[model samples]
Target: MSFKKRGPFVSLQLMSRWKNLVGLNVSIGGFVGKYPHCFEIFTHPFRRNLCCKITQKLKEVIVEEENVIRECEIDAVKRVKKLLLMSKNRVLRVHALRLIRKELGLPEDFRDSVLAKYSLDFKLVDLETLELVDDDDDDDDESLGVAKVEEWREVEYREKWLSEFEMNYAFPINLPTGFKIEKGFREELKNWQRVAYVKPYERKDMSRGVERFEKRVVAIIHELLSLTVEKMVEVERLAHFRKDLGIEVNVREVLLKHPWIFYVSTKGSTQTVFLREAYSKGCLIDPNPVYNVRRKMLELVLLKNRHSKELSRTGDETHEEKSDVVISSHDDWEGERDGDWVLPILMKSD
Candidate 1:
């Protein structure tokens, strides 16, 4: 039978409100009435177009609603159907079913579907009644219809697997022996593994762990390689400075071009002769970037000796000469001050 129509104005209004029906069940009376305003508007040809538009929009909403209901019911069905077959633990079964219903957007304070495939119900202590309920389920019977719930569940599981697989990015690594490839990368990997309980999962955990580990490791290794190269540059600079400054008194300069250098230079005369080399070496030392920035701050503390044999000859002569000069100068200066200088005496033994 043809449905009653509404006027163009009313039909347009209804069209505007069509999308709001999402998740709402279309009332039978509302559908049948077509409403007085809607009928008047929809009777005209132009108004009829508005009615059609509204109807199409409502159809889309209906389809989406159906899908949501189907999905939610499917979850409950899987739980209940499984419960029915295993045939025990009524409380758990009911709870699972209730959870599924809630997930499906069904009312929390409501009854199970009145139109459930089976019209059976059971009270506590009625084990026979429960058994009958299970037996009546068409889902378990092969001769009966295939449960759409099972099909939907498989689809859901497949979707989940694909989504998680796409995100998997960890790799297996043997710790202690395998150094990190990135800065702090090893620690991050360890934390992730621990959080995921990867060790207990073994192979499954390793597969993902290793993949993620590889990326982080590669990044770390690159940084370390760069740092090593930078360190070598510093060492070479030091070697060039030492050789140029002529501080090769003891240690051999065999490995002058080596990545690591051993050498020293004086800050005084040595610096002037080997200024360029010294400067280059200083630049390479890069105290700020090194592990211990203060390593270069220490200066030599030299101890002087008063009676060392090496300086004894010069020491005696200087001591005697300085004493004579001090005595003569003191007496002469005093006489001049008193204005009694009687021709500054030049004493000598003829």
Candidate 2:
């Protein structure tokens, strides 16, 4: 939550305004208090108001995470280049790129650091759009036109010795746990997998049939998920790229229809789509630096409850010790009360 704040500390009053944004049922102070390990509550000396800030440990973790991302700038550039190559026009909207910037491991200032720095590879047409520059005149069309999935398809064909009809158009699918295989399900799945469609990076004529068009949309989504760090993204976030990616149908419905290739999780407030093959037991099969840093952040957040419990127990012990000392002092006074009466009377009389 502090990561989203613009300043070092956020006032309780200001944080209250973000209650709806953060989906908090209680006051911001109450929510922040729960996460003692992650956040520190303090009073501003000048303002004399309650404020919240991230703990020193959490701040260091955030800085370390940023440094890790900075170190991976080369890979981030490559991801952006591949994205441009995957687009229909070899151009993508700046807004769409911003939506998935973190997922793609690009820096916060990617506009200047990435697009402007690599001027020979990327042409900034305007403030809102960028295009890929053709660096080599001798480069053939086929070399620039391949989609990432084509490699997987080729391997499937060569290693499995599957027929061209089965391997060329098929996508790898991994069903989720407890997915019952109904009668004729395998036959139906096989038929759908064999249906041919235009690859995501390939050009298609307007006269293509509905089946082919929908299948191409599936390919586009698969490629997009593969590009992400987690191989998962919110369904709503993906909707922002619909126009730029040439997806016309309902994205949610499309994901639901192909459950084998994708998994729609409604576990939280947002519906997230995950590439089935990229994950095992709810974890990414191959984690990247950015993903590892994010997992560290999660661990820090989860430690808050345990930290709070420890503090509570220490406070209770301190209170008990004080009570025991007071009780002992009271007992000593009672025992000496009968003998001390003479000294008190003498002092009063004098």
Which model scores highest in lDDT? 2
Native-vs-model 2 lDDT? 0.70
Predict model 1's lDDT versus the native.
0.27
What TM-score quantifies how close candidate 2 is to the native fold?
Answer: 0.80
Q: Which candidate comes out best when scored by TM-score?
A: 2
lDDT per model, in order?
A: 0.27, 0.70
Q: Residue 36 in candidate 1 has what lDDT?
A: 24
RMSD of 1: 45.1
- Candidate 2: tens digits of C-alpha lDDT, residues 1-350: 23223246655566566668645566666766666766665544544455556655677767777798789887777777777776777798988898778788777789998889989778999998989886657364455456657778889888989889887888988886799999999998898888788787666653278887888889889988888887887788888878767887899999999998998887635678888888777677889988777777777666656645443222112111111110111112222223211000000000
Q: Give the per-residue lDDT digits (tens) of candidate 1, residues 1-350.
A: 22322211233323334434322244322332332211111232322222211222233433454455444553334433333332223223234334333222333332435223434532323322222243544544442222222233356557756333322322223332243366887576555433322221122322245434333322222111122212222222222322222222222223221111112233322211111211243443432222121121111001112122232231112111111111111112221123211111111110
Q: Lowest lDDT 10-mer window, candidate 2?
A: 341-350
Give TM per candidate.
0.20, 0.80
